[model samples]
Target chain A: MNSLMAIFRFELNRILTPGRVFWWVVVAAFPVVIMLLMMNYLQPPRGATQENINTFFTIALYFVAPTVSCMLGALLIAAPAVASELEQHSWTYLAVRPNGLFHLVLGKYLVAVVWAASATIVGVTVAVAVAGIEDPGDAQELNQDDTVVAATDDRAVRRGGRFPGETATDVVPGIVATGEVGRAMVGLAILSACSYSALYIMLGTLFHRRAMVLCVAYTAAVELFLGFFPAVINRLTIQYRLRTLLFDWTTQSDEFRNSGVLDFVSSDESAFMQVLWLVSWTAVFLAIALVSVHVREFTSASETDV
Target chain B: MTSEYLIELDHVTKLYGTVIGVNDFNAQLKPGAYGLLGPNGAGKSTLLNLLIGQLVPTRGTVRVLGQSPRNNSAFMKKIGFCPGFEGLYATTTGLDWVTLLLQLHGVRSRPARARAADCLALVGMSNDMNRPIATYSRGMRQRIKLAQSMAHEPTLLFLDEPFSGLDPVGRTEMTNVLNDWIGLGNSLIIASHVLHEIEALTDSFLLICGGRLLASGTASEVNELLFDSPSEIEVDCSEPYRLASVLMDRELAVSISVEQKSHGGDTVRLRTLRAGQLWSQLPDLITRNGFTVTRVRSADDSLQTLFNSLLKIHRGEI
Candidate 1:
């Protein structure tokens, strides 16, 4: 429809404004340094059979996706979500024309998704390609050896991923590639970015100016906190659900899957069941966001009252 | 082009729970110029919002261009409104703002751009087209607000205090633009407390008080109910001495006295519009052949009486 296209064009033009573009460039370009580092001289041990390149790419995204998506999508939607229009006194300018509550909510929601998706795609793709090109040594010890616990000193990079050791360095630590399963790892990084964007956009609508506080407290106390707990909270935290969707986990013995990580939740339930949980929670949050948009009065603070 | 009345409200009343916005209001409006004259906090803004279908009434129905205005696109297209406050996109350029408005009204491409330019020119702000509204002065902002309202050629205009915060020059320009807008058989409903400003724009008025319809008619009709109290009349007598002597003995007349002043020799001023009783007997004392006389005017035809009578009626002691 022309109206939908007009709304999309208007929203895209708004995001491409100078101030927003400058910030997007910064967020999109942060993982390029990691890519450059990996391309320098990190070849695998001579004569070591190289696994598929896709695993390394998934390993790369594990680092950049979490940081970039949180800052870009979670924090970015705060402005266009609800408060910016109030500051501009643009209600009459917007409401007079028939961009009713539904259109307004839909337009902003779509922009937030596209914005986060663009930033996340860059970080994920570059990290994936760069990780695939570079190689790490000691394949048997890293992938299969039993008593070889991950060393702490070189492991301080601590980027989360599909693997068990330093063989991967994108942003988050530990991307492991077993056998010939590479493409599934790439799919995992993308799923992480999308799920995170959806959750935060819903939060942005629910809490207008206080979005940062909610995200920080939720990320720290709930997500990181629950990830540490031995209980089944992985079904709720975004990080856990994202990790559950990425790696092809069979039993609970994989290094990244050991004990209190995402594996504990996966220890009992199948990967498909965990994905269902992620989707159900996403639906719940989206429903809350729609209600928030409908109830919150779109009054401008500067010149309008009551 | 719809030939029927653009807006019609029948006993529309709105209450914010206990506090009332507009109470028992009824109006039949055709396509012409109309002024909604009322003091501050007089519910002028409330009535305007109801007409636009932004707020629903508790009691009666309001029909704009024959359909209920609530989400009625066909009716909304014919009515353009500038609310009590300046609702502008502070970041948008003046030209782009109007163009967007016209485009939303289904004006496409180059013609929308051309019409936007013409609208800015009519509001006397073509030079400031590139500037963001955030940087504009109050008068310039008001002009842009008007340009957006009229850009789409709406048939019914609802302007709530459009002349507020305008300098004398800006006021004249805005009034002229609105007057010209209504010249093409279009209608305007404007609200203002400035009597002189309202007087210049339209003679018909709606006086609102305590969320009630206090008075509605031509300006003079409301004025007559407000100020004309004493039964006084001006007489052009043929014989000054004889005519002056005749009016001295009336009981209802307040000290029936005659004073001579300006204009050719002697003149008398009286304070009444009920001149029929005085003219019947005044010819008895004076002969027209002695001196041919000319003018007769009501001394109490002042706005002060209308204002006082309005206040009295508001207090419920009248």
Candidate 2:
């Protein structure tokens, strides 16, 4: 217990110094600034209604949040825990210490988890606050439209020929049943942050020296190709689970949202399935994280010959 | 292994594939200061790693404090180590690194901080304790690594090339600090290639060559194995030809020769064995003979010479 805590504190303080904190703030701000810029150009000129404003906010949370969180986790946690140590050649010193390797991994993981979750919360909070003012009680709707409107997989076609507009009676009842979108957004934020944290920690642990490169490849694999599939495929993707939890939080729209077009790491599946898959898979990776932290040979035995 | 000895190695051999690390090594280090003497790649590092349970052996049992070193958790707190690399977290100050390492072994933060201070003081690094290691010089960094290991107050210490990079003054300072450590009842295993460094701290030495234990004991014990065979003695005399002509009958002086000095002077150097044997039979030769003897030195007997002789003898025997 003492060994673990000592290593934990060392790992934590090593990465959370003032300089690192400043860099992290910049990385977290990138998505928010971009989201706001895009939303401004797309917002209707005079005023926006419930439908358009909710749709914009949904796009921000679904598309912007995951990219920011995962990248931040990798840079701050995975990079430091594994890559920085290798570059510093501190692994040689750690190898002989009684329990230095385990401490390093734990410290980086815990700090990254906290940092990722907090970034998501702050981003989502700002986006939600701005959206709520523009369109109050806009996201509580459940089903968007009864009529098959588009003759396409993209929308819930309605009795009318065109996409449902703001104040369209078809969307009001659906909003009333599902409640607002932000509450569910927060929960998905927490779960997705934790899952990504576990995933990065595992990746870092498995490949000691090149953990950063390996993690980048993994993020691209899981978050891009597999991340685009619908509910069922999303069940197998990290973003899907988080997105499913936020499905009800999304603005009720007559037309379907290509979540990836508006979202990422988001799923069309039920929130319950999303939670089950993300949390359970995350739990297994968490085990990998723990064992990797414990058993990793921090330093290579190959003594360099100069 | 016997319990009286703090560490005992019996026919220990470590091999990584076909390359030998330690070949059929045997040693017993009692609870006192002992220097491991060897050159680079001479297996001293491997031996220390094995002693601390950092490594497992291929064919030998190494016992530390009378228990197997491999995964022996209890003995860990009793052992301290300062590796040759001297690597520390640059972001963390010396105090932080030392405190954290101690905390891992169950020391509380408050006490660890205090102990870290004391340890830094011991290594003459207290003033620089708050500075990050990145700002430290090579010697200062070494001092911090030393402080971390000593902060634990371990019973057994393994310092690999602790004095390697130290300047002469730094080496002297470290030698003094090491004296303080062993001035108490603790034992230390210091590895170094400098023969004088080992001679300064320990009389018992383990001389390694080509990954094998060539000799293990006091200097004189090793010397005995090297020079136990009779040695030749040379004497510069005024009448070398006359003395050489009469000395052929001496039993022990199997070979005798007289050579004029390189300057082509009258002086002749007499090579003989058991000069006393010749003196006993020709008592008058010492006092009445017109012979002024000038030179007497070992035929092959400086420490370096004896060390070489030991290696040669082993090479021939094996």
In DockQ, how does model 1 score against the reference complex? 0.22
Please estimate how well model 1 matches the true structure, expressed as its whole-model Cα lDDT.
0.61
Q: Candidate 1 - CAPRI tier? A: incorrect
Docking class of 2: acceptable
Candidate achieving the largest DockQ = 2
Candidate 1 lDDT over residue span A1-306, tens digit each? 333444445666667778887777666666655655654544533222223223343444544565444345545753346556545556555555643444555556566666766665565555544444212344223444322234433332223222343343323222344222234434543454445555665776666667657766666677667754667665567666655555443122233344344446333556787667667776776667667655444432223222
Which stretch of 10 consecutive residues in model 1 chain B shows the poorest summed lDDT?
B248-257
List A-chain TM-scores for all predictions. Answer: 0.67, 0.70
Query: What residue runs in model 2 are displaced by over 4 Å at the alpha carbon?
Result: A1-5, A16-19, A43-56, A92-98, A130-186, A230-236, A248-283, A289-301, A304-306, B1-3, B10-19, B58-61, B70-72, B228-307, B311-318
Q: Which tens-of-lDDT digit does each residue in A53-84 have in candidate 2?
A: 45545655556665555456544575446666
Worst 10 residues of 2 chain A by lDDT: A170-179
Q: Judge candidate 1 at residue B173 and give its lDDT.
A: 88
Cα lDDT for residue B192, model 2? 79
